[model samples]
Target: MIKTGLYFGSFNPIHVGHMAIANYMVEYTDIDQLWFVVSPQNPLKKKKTLLDDYHRLELVNRAIGDDLRFRASKVEFGLPKPSYTIDTLAYLSEKYPTHQFFILMGSDNLESIHKWKNADVLLANYDIIVYPRPGFNPESAEKYPRVQIANAPLMEISSTFIRDAIKEGKDIRHFLPYRSWDYLQQMNFYKK
Candidate 1:
């Protein structure tokens, strides 16, 4: 059976940190392939200045390129708003019955995961791969036995920080993937 890991995120702009976590998950975990599931909207977050969903998805694709092990998916775009992980997981399970699925997330997300829709079903069915986020510790995963904490290289870069730098006319070359950086510059994205 093919093992696949679903890494769901807003990825308003795909950055090096997001890529690092996805790379580490497949390299270090049992996951054979990692899909960066670009969410249209996160229920927990306030939708104010979110980048266009297609643009965000395109950025993720640019960052991932033709990596056979890594893929970009817009599974939630067809689904309802505040895309629930459980609902997506259920849909995927039925759609791809042959592939085993796992959820890849950051420690920060796990901190408030209990509040998610059908959190109990998600915990009961799928395995979770949690990586450390900047300012967030890994100890929080101890509470969830099904969670696997990854010791991947912790990158401090975040989309928010990258956006801020771009808006402020600061350099962000080092924070995003080279191709993504080039694409962003070519399109003049994130400039205030």
Candidate 2:
């Protein structure tokens, strides 16, 4: 069976930090492949800041490039809005019967996972790989036996910071992938 880890996020603009984490997961874990499931509308976040779904998807494709082990998925885009993890997982399972799916999340998300739809079903069915985030205690994950704390490099940068930088006329070249940066520049995204 294929060991596929699903890393779900809005990826308003796929940044270098996101790339680093994806690279780290493939190199350090038993996961055979990592799929970046770009969510159309994150249930926990406001939609006002999100770029168009297709734009964000194209950015993700550019960021991943020809990496064999890394993939960008638009599964949620085809699904209903306010996409829930449980629904995505179910859909993925049906579509890829030979793959064992896992959830890749940050400690911050794990801290409030209880608020997610069918959180218990998610935890009970699949393993969770939790990466560290500022102010988030990975130890909180100890209660869940299936949760593994990974020591990936912690980059303090966020997409919000990147968007704000673009709006403020700051250079954010070092924060994003080259191809993605080129597309963002060509499209003049996030400029006020």
Candidate 2 stretches with Cα past 4 Å from truth are none
> Ten-residue segment with the worst summed lDDT in candidate 2?
134-143
Runs with alpha carbons beyond 4 Å of true place in candidate 1: 134-139
Worst 10 residues of 1 by lDDT: 132-141
Clashes of each: 0, 0
For all the candidates, what are their Cα RMSDs to the real structure? 1.3, 0.7
Give a tens-digit lDDT track for model 1, residues 100-182: 99998878889999899989888877899888777776676777788888888888778889988999999869888888898
RMSD of 1: 1.3
Highest TM-score: which candidate? 2
lDDT, candidate 2, at 42: 87
C-alpha TM-score for every candidate: 0.95, 0.98
